[model samples]
Target: MDAVHVHMTNTSNLPVEALENEYPLRMDEYAMIQDSGGAGRTRGGMGIAKQIRAVGPGIVFSARSDSHTVGVAAGVDGGRDGRRARLIRNFGTPQQEELFSKTANIALAAGESVRIETPGGGGYGAPSARPQPRVAQDVADGKISAEAARADYGLSA
Candidate 1:
């Protein structure tokens, strides 16, 4: 299997110091992608996007899925679904950029950074087929609002 690996150190007062001390590089920022989940009957697993701003010049390597389009996960029988993954960066730039490569390796400067958008899980069945308890749990967990869950998932939450 293919994978992306990153090495960095932290120079700030953030909790990342431990990582920096443990690693051989420094990092200015790190975060996951916003929303990249899929929708399907069984709900495919969500993709993961990570970004790290280099505190200094360093090399970065990443491997990700090539399918930038989000697709509905195949449901067991019939269930509501989830959305796909979409990646965007430098939205204000005169021209939009799309990074659909399965692997990326580059040297970044202090102010340079990369954004990764992962895919979300797919729905298991028809939206109305989901259980009320599941919908309620989603609401409680802040994954979905009560109104949305009720209207979309047909739950009482």
Candidate 2:
């Protein structure tokens, strides 16, 4: 029989250095996507973006991801929905393309790249119920923008 591996969740705690050392790839970017979390009194968790570039021969990509077309779940009590996931090929280039959430066997040449943005968690309550201090802190910490604070949480400058 052939060997198979399965995961209980889409999340992984693998470090970029480990991946780069193990595979013929280079980490182009790996960071949390700002404002990707659902807005609420208790805000949802943020999503992450990871971009990898092929640096050697014979690199192929595949994934069975979700939440690309819709949020993880509907928000509760007037809370905003979570941001959806995305898989991009050659991001920031004129030939950039958005790929399917579930796809397999994408050929990657040297210098070509792929980016995956994971879905954020759903919010639990109305965004207006969130405190101004928390919103300000989020903005200060770069979790959300000042404009997002004003628009989503009704915070004033």
Candidate 3:
């Protein structure tokens, strides 16, 4: 698990040691990614990419939805869909990153941090629901499994 503190400005006048003591996780380094969100008719919310240097090994879990789940974008006459959330790790590696994993064993020294970049949600309705054949193709391509397609997306095998 990871925690981040976003301070709008440096007006607190607190020392770095004080801030670190207040937070649960130690901060080795931090940076913000600009303009990571996608555009849609209703305009999707902006995406944020963050890198965290873990002070210790811990578990991580995430769940997020936009128009499809709770109607964040307020579907077009009940046609809008929410954006999907993704989890990736070891980004920019030649082996590529894993989209979703139950657990990751991380060995971090005193000054090691991992990078995480989450994708923005897509538009709802027609664009959200693609052709069944394409969905099957995704299964065949290993992007998703047949059982996962049926279970997650309610698609027929």
Q: Pick the candidate with the highest lDDT.
A: 2
TM-score of 3: 0.35
Supply candidate 3's per-residue lDDT for 66. 30
lDDT of 3 by residue, 37-124 (tens): 2222222233334544445445343423232223232334323333333344444546444444233454444334445443333333
lDDT of 3 at 150: 64
List the candidate 1 regions with Cα displacement exceeding 4 Å.
1-44, 58-64, 69-72, 80-82, 86-97, 102-107, 145-151, 155-157
Stretches of model 3 off by over 4 angstroms after superposition: 1-19, 22-36, 55-99, 124-157
| Residue 9 miss distance in model 2 (angstroms) | 2.3
Using all chains and alpha carbons, the TM-scores for the candidates as numbered come to 0.54, 0.88, 0.35
- State the C-alpha lDDT per candidate: 0.46, 0.81, 0.40
Query: Which ranges of candidate 2 are over 4 A from the true structure?
Result: 1-11
Task: Name the candidate, 1 or 2, with the larger lDDT value.
Answer: 2
Q: Which number leads on TM-score?
A: 2
